[model samples]
Target chain A: MTSAEATAHYFKKAARIMDVGERIETLLAAPLREVKVQVSIELDNGEIRTFDGYRVQHDNSRGPMKGGLRYHPEVDSDEVLSLASLMTWKTAVVNLPFGGAKGGIRVDPIGLSSKELERLTRKFVDQIQDIIGPTRDIPAPDVNTNPQVMAWIMDQYSKYHGHSPAVVTGKPIDLYGSRGREAATGRGLLYIAREIARDVGLPVKGTRFAVQGFGNVGSHAARLVHEDGGIIVAVSDVNGGVKNPKGLDVPALFDHARKTGSVKGFGGGVPCGSEELLTCDCDVLIPAALGSVLTRSVAAEVRAKIILEGANAPCTPEADEVFEKKGVLVVPDILANAGGVTVSYFEWVQNLQHVTWDEDRVNTELEKLMREAYERVANISRTRKLPLRTSAYVLAIGRVGKATVLRGI
Target chain B: MLDQLMKLPMCKGLSQGEATELASIARESQAKKGTVLFAQGAHGDSILVVLEGQIEVSMSGQTLAQVGEGSVLGEMSLLGEGGKRTATATVLSDARLLEIDAARFQELLKTSHLAALKVVANLAQVMSKRLLAMNEKLIEGNKGKKEELADFQKILSNWSF
Candidate 1:
């Protein structure tokens, strides 16, 4: 199934459990607005290129829409819509005062020069500037995007609105970006994993972990978990995977990866396939890569006790069922990866107030928020006898549902 | 005061003797908190450098920038041909400021070509950074309005023919 179909499948399951009426279900499922624009720019080689760009505003009953703008070849209306809906649940899961939106340009950024990329970003902003604002829809960084990209968006938006830094988050610190935002997703995953490890009677000191991706989230989670005495036995990236049963030296591996551009040839570990890294024997498995990797077939062979989803839609519904049958706990993406958005919210607050916060304040606030959300989800899971994913959805769907009803729509 | 003046980017790269000469031309003045050093659109004659305390750059009562020690203020007016202050400078705290008139600025430029070149280069860098930031913003504002107009034209095209 497509990503949107998968999102709808999970939404249907949660709605059924909540016994939501058909009318409300339909209303909640449909997006509020879908915008498609042609973003054309001149390449440095004097050639003109055009890209299809999309901004899907899924829901805004709770507050202003908030999401990311990615620059990737796979970005389309379907993916944007699915992600926008996920943002709705994610913000609600964390209980932030925001709704949901997602936008992206369907172009591979690797081929474009820095100047061309800036031009494209500015052009995309031009197309959607009317629909986005600090109090309308705020965009953050996503796949193939970073602080520099956010800085561009903020600078671009400020020109129109007279220095409105809150129009976008994840900007450079020099340009009103928040501290601790870069490590937020991975750090959040660590916080939630710690809570789960504690509840399961597994101490972090000796638990083995195999992370499926070594990007920002995986790297940060591995380093933090290692610092907490967790052994990261295996890790992978797009280039390849590496494994060391005695636990690889995370700092050395990080340096090696940085220099060599992959974890394949690190001296501390033997090279392994990406699939082997996923199904490796470990106490915890984190899928911080792309979505749908944990299909039913892959899930059936999994050896991990707990799965922390650090990427969006990393597990299919079929995989969720397989894990359920196998009695493995799955922490849903909405809860696991909500850290990035949570910190984004803090950055937006700081910008709107014309103040900057220290890194310590950002990290402390993140831990408090993540832990509180985990506790609330855990409480519902125990009292309702539901899986963590279901409980998270229950908590989120209830909030959105109540807001939708109270607003008379 | 010379040490602080040397720390400013516009005064960097100057030799100790050159810095001392530049500092000699500057008149140090004290301003209490809530002092308005200059108002927006006032005739600009001198550029002020902060040696201690904070100054707020504001327009129409909205604070645009907060500058502290080793910061050069009102340089844009000195650089601009029109010689009009773009923003009002208000003291946020009791401040020590070094003010250099246009005549003294020219004297330093004539006395040492090296110091003058460094100052002009630094000023260019500062102005370019501000221009780039404002350019990004202006592109957003202008392009957004233009895109809306294009969208209107597209709809009108559909109905016209």
Candidate 2:
């Protein structure tokens, strides 16, 4: 399922445990705003490539709209909607004073040159600038998007808003990006995993973990876990994966992956398929790559006790059902992967105020919030006797619901 | 009094006298424990510094550290070109504080470039040291975990935790 379908599916599941009155259902069914714009950019080849872009401000009942702009070949309204919805819950899940939104273009960012990418980003921002503001909707980095992309978006947005740095988060630090943001997502993943492990009575040392994907999130997660004394037995990337029964050297693997862009030829372990990387025996299995990696089939064969989702929508509803039956504990993406946004929130606050914080403050603050959120979700799971994913949704929805009610909306 | 107050590192480099002058530029307020001084991520015109007692640095409700007795809590957001309060600083005890507007802080920096430079340089050094320590801590903390895990794995080579 796409991020949108996964979002709707999770909402439906969470709503089952909620009051879900007519008013609540109405609020949850569709986004608060869905913006579609035509982004026309001239390619280096002198041909114009027009791409449809979307910025779905899912909800802003809590505060401003916060999310990322994805650039992928599989981008679509449904997927964007799902991600937007997820952003809403993810922000709420972490208790950030914001709502959720997500945007994307259909074209592949990798196919675009630096100039083409800048032109496309600027055009998209120009079309959507009216709807986004520091207090309205804030965008950040996502798949195939980074600080540079954010800087472009900020610059484009500024052309209309008079150099408003608060208009965007995740810009280059020179442009108001927060320190420690590059590692926030991975750090958040490590934090969530640590909390879950503690609750499940798994010692951090010698705990085996398998990570699928060696990109920013995956590599950081692997390195952190390895640093935390967890034996990272397997790790993968787009090319393939590597596994060692004795535990892969996360730093070495990170170095190799950085040098090679893939973990296949790391010379430390035998190569394995990305699919097999998920089913490998380990205490924790983190899917940090693309979505749908943990479909129904893979979920059935998976043996890890915990499934911490780093990638959005890595698990489909069918896969979720299988995992539910297999008694696998799944930390839903919104809660499990909210560290990035929490830090992004910090970065934005820093930017708008022209302040910078030490990384310790960032990571410490992140750990405190993520752990507390995890504890709350885990408690809800136990109290409601619901799965973790469902519990997370219920917790988030309930928080947002309370806010909506308190605001008399 | 204003000139002397400006000499403090946390003052953002107003001469003690300039800080006093700048302090007069905004509303002065006193807060007690449980008083919400300012919240994380808030952008406004004012910056607060502890004049007496203590302020607790918090984010998402957890107290990370404390600021007390002439320490600056909100200047990070005031002196920088683009800044906002990254963490909420709550009054940990009944205390006196000087709240200065962003404009006044900038004005003071402009009026006394020497004082401003000194203040900026001091904050820069403090932030740099803090950041370096945090980075090393992050790496070392992880290394500690890894070492413990390796030892555990060695022990568990024949058993389990």
- Against the true structure, what is each candidate's TM-score? 0.71, 0.70
List DockQ, one per candidate, in order: 0.00, 0.01
lDDT of 2 at B126: 78
True contacts kept of 1: 0.00
What candidate 2 gets wrong by more than 4 Å, as runs, is: A1-3, B1-161
Model number with the top TM-score = 1
Alpha-carbon shift of residue A242 in model 2 (angstroms): 0.7
Q: Candidate 1, clashing residue pairs?
A: A159-B137
Stretches off by above 4 angstroms in model 1 are B1-161
Candidate 1 residues A137-190, lDDT tens each? 999998898889888888887778788889999889888888998889999999
